[model samples]
Target: MVVPVPPPPLLASHVAVRAAASAISHGRRVLLNGDHPPQVAALGRGDWVKLICGASFEDAADVRNLSLVYTLAGVDCIDCAADASVVGAVNEGIEVAASIVPTVQRPWLMISVNDDCRDLHFRKAEFDPDDCPLDCSKPCEKVCPADAISLKHSMVDGERTLSDPLRGKYEGGVITERCYGCGRCLPVCPYDRIRAVSYVRDPTMTAELLKRDDVDAIEIHTTGKGTDMFNTLWDNLSGSINNVKLVAVSLPDIGESTVDLMNTIYTIMEPHFKGYNLWQLDGRPMSGDIGRGATRETVSFAAHVASMSERPPGFYQLAGGTNSYTVDYLKKAGLFQSSNWNSGTATSEMASSHQALIGGIAYGGYARKIVGRVLRKIPEQFGRVHIEDHPDHLLEALQEAMSLVGPVKGYIPSHSKPFMKQVDRQ
Candidate 1:
């Protein structure tokens, strides 16, 4: 009997980096995959794009990480260190661009800032030296609710830089890499350097659906807060339809309403509404496209509501999912979208007519309506919290509050292990 030997499997590293003289084909262009030229920074990436090459830029009010290599369509991150020759209009290609930021596992989850902004300073850039009017009374500290901000002066590679409201200075200069892009302090600040990153042209996939002739699929971004708040609001508005028109939603730590609407929608709704949705997702329609607040039933129901109220439902899902991340533009929208029909603009609305109220908000309606439902449930688990309806200026004021006191709360080193036990306790 003769014996034969098999060759060992080759590792990727061991494989030769060879390329033929002929062009290698791709979705459109032929990539050499070897040497690449340097890239020049173009205009800042567009925010909140409505149409990306006639496709879907704002596919979801909040599109979590679909892991789409938009690079195929020439969608590249301004910060992406990838090789150039592979970007831009190589052929009659790339008519649009997606927000080239990284996606989160949960589209609706805001980067739980939890900051306390005070006397934060930019790293290496001395306000006194640059003649920055250098007003450090820093109102941002007084406003941040999450305690994720701070204000401090420190050294970075041996330079005095003021990084504030963060209670700590940048090691060198203002590195956006260190910023959560909350921009809570922008309006209050005297300078232009400190700013949060918001989507440029925040897409409205739902609105796009509204413009179409056929309404088939629909997505609903729900907070696992609960359904009671929504039900109450709906029930109380027994005869009013206008109150559900301009569904104004807000998330916990919005850059401001100036930011996209979707991000704020996730947080503004009472947590009760969010929690109920989550419970129902797990107990009831678990088989449908139900995911927490974004239950398949809820989405379908929202479509039903929309169809009855306005149009048919399409493929809509809650902005929050288990595969999205938050940072820069990619995860920005989830930081805003809300749980209910502030106006049923997206999948958050329902059909309810309130005779006395306007724009779906009525005096004592939301509170009184939702309060009974909360009381009926786990009385031990329920606690009453006062909520304020933010006027546009009020929203700006809160953003200013974030500005005056946001950094001290937001700039925590992701690697820091001090374990903010009290933060969790609260």
Candidate 2:
């Protein structure tokens, strides 16, 4: 069987071990071994009589990377050579119990990922020359995030070289560099983008595996180059960066003081983000549990669908809660570049719901307050104060819905919110 190991850098090389091959055509050889029967001449091909019994075919050209198309437990069954030339804890012996056919491609089967590839996890960030000292080479310096590595100076052609500063020299203890071992430079670099090189399943490798002809199945192994390997693929399958519309605003609908204050904020701040932001989707009619809104569920569903379709999907999370944490999640979800969001709901939804998310009414109130604040601060009042009503399209639709609700409309509280509530004693 062919074992395809991760191709390590030049420093460390990986090798494939061949497994053994057993099982010969027992019934056919013994019973009809003597008969050099006809080779299906009637089927129409050339004149070649063939042995009806099976053959324990062994050809060097037929073997290469071995992979288990299917699996029962942690054990695997791959298509390699007659030798145990593969990786895994399976017995070092080969055994072909029945119906052995010689072919190039292995059958396509599902293989469980157990101790499949541990070498990759630890080797995620590897360097050449394990014994290489942290001299001025700065091999990992440019990649450090915390700027933790302090450096000393070394001169070239009479000028002090800053690019490759020697880290804490042993001084007369190992006498090397010229400058006083100043640790200042290291602590100053932000090193925000520092990290080990990342890897993904090689597309060419996949194409090659899919080309297998002997076995009916195909299996691939990864050294876990990323956090969510599966998600990394699917979430990024579609174009990574999705361009959509978004905005920020505040609305009033939750009622119970929250509504009143929110509306007040809209009346005040709506002008700030108005006419600019796109409507957020995860909004409107605050309900039980944020997930109760169809938008929330829909967003999650989109994520799943992306996975199935081998593509990435967009998101509509609110922005006020936006900080390092949310950004990190978005980045991990591969949605950072695809998400569309604004600050408030009232203004955004009021403007448009064209693929947007709406969250808290408090957010809308805040947006309204922003509008009021911005307009109030502007130097001009009349002709200069051009309020854009484009954002109100969704609100307008809701308004028409209310008018059509008829008798049931009286029971339904206005979405605009002078929010009255059912008096539950609880």
Candidate 3:
């Protein structure tokens, strides 16, 4: 008997689109985090939400889809790799999202690069599968969040023996393009085969990408080893510094020296830094997808930085271990938007500014894992499928994105209210 094929995917009706758009506006309008739009009041109100596309995650298709979904969810920025193709993918996704919801704010596009090779975000996992025992169970593949690893075995000569170590060949290894160097797979390899290879991004190419109009921000990942490398990289990009609207420096906690390093870095940027600056307190570093425990380090980092009497001159944001539980953690820590805590070095001015002590949060691995579920449901044949092309998936993805973003923005449930009309766009 022959089976009938399923119907073509249905597009969302105009009414459905309007409802989705209305929900977004309502959510933004009612955000308890602050009364201002996240982009305008993010730093001040501590409600900025940035979608990190992984500094090393170069998957164009995934990046584009994530951009579109998060844009509709109302994030303030989308942080991605510094490559030209990746930037194009992010812009393409943002434009598509705007097309769908016309009034959706165009989030600032930020590119990430590292000054030092030792930084974990600038690495990739590598190993040779040929040396592996055929019978070995692959835990690396199972632990990988990005699905960067693949292995397949086949019987030779259509025969197998218990003693035959070479009975089959492993067909696939790490897909370099998909690997974001999260380092999760490095520890799970029982054979001790997997190792991380680190590299610094080229300054020339980064400067060139900064000149593009679509690019609005730049994140420089530093190892806090010292200011030597950061100074060099900063000087290299000074020529193109005016090209973007904001500059963000991502660094880890190095104890007492952390504040000093931040101050020094700020001094470096102060002369040429015409745009807004933010300090990314990367606590646990790329562990957001692990679980609840991962979020603590970042929250702790924010609290630690918030209490500091001499932090620096810039917005402070949490990263590395951020997840859905982060906002609650921040609220509990009294750092969410407390005006009492002073983080910046300009104590008098900062106190008067009345901006939220902790600016906002950036979601990376955890963000992808949530919406990625719906994206994975789409069939492989529909390569490079725009989330908007499949409105059902787009709406589902938007819902997932909002679940994580809304709480931070103080979104109230619109359970009883009638759907509002869509806003008129310029």
- Candidate with maximal TM-score: 3
Candidate 1: segments with Cα more than 4 A from true spot: 1-135, 141-150, 155-182, 196-308, 314-426
lDDT of 1 by residue, 77-192 (tens): 11110112211221101111111111211111110100111101111111221322334554544433112244445555565545433333422323222232333445665555
For candidate 2, the lDDT comes to: 0.23
- Any idea what lDDT model 3 has? 0.82
TM-score per prediction, in order, is 0.20, 0.17, 0.88
Predicted structure 1: lDDT? 0.21
Better of 2 and 3 by lDDT: 3
For each candidate, the alpha-carbon lDDT, in order, equals: 0.21, 0.23, 0.82
lDDT of 2 by residue, 35-85 (tens): 211111100111111110000111121111011101100011232211111
The worst-scoring run of ten residues by lDDT in candidate 1 lies at 16-25
Ranked by TM-score from best down, the candidates are 3, 1, 2
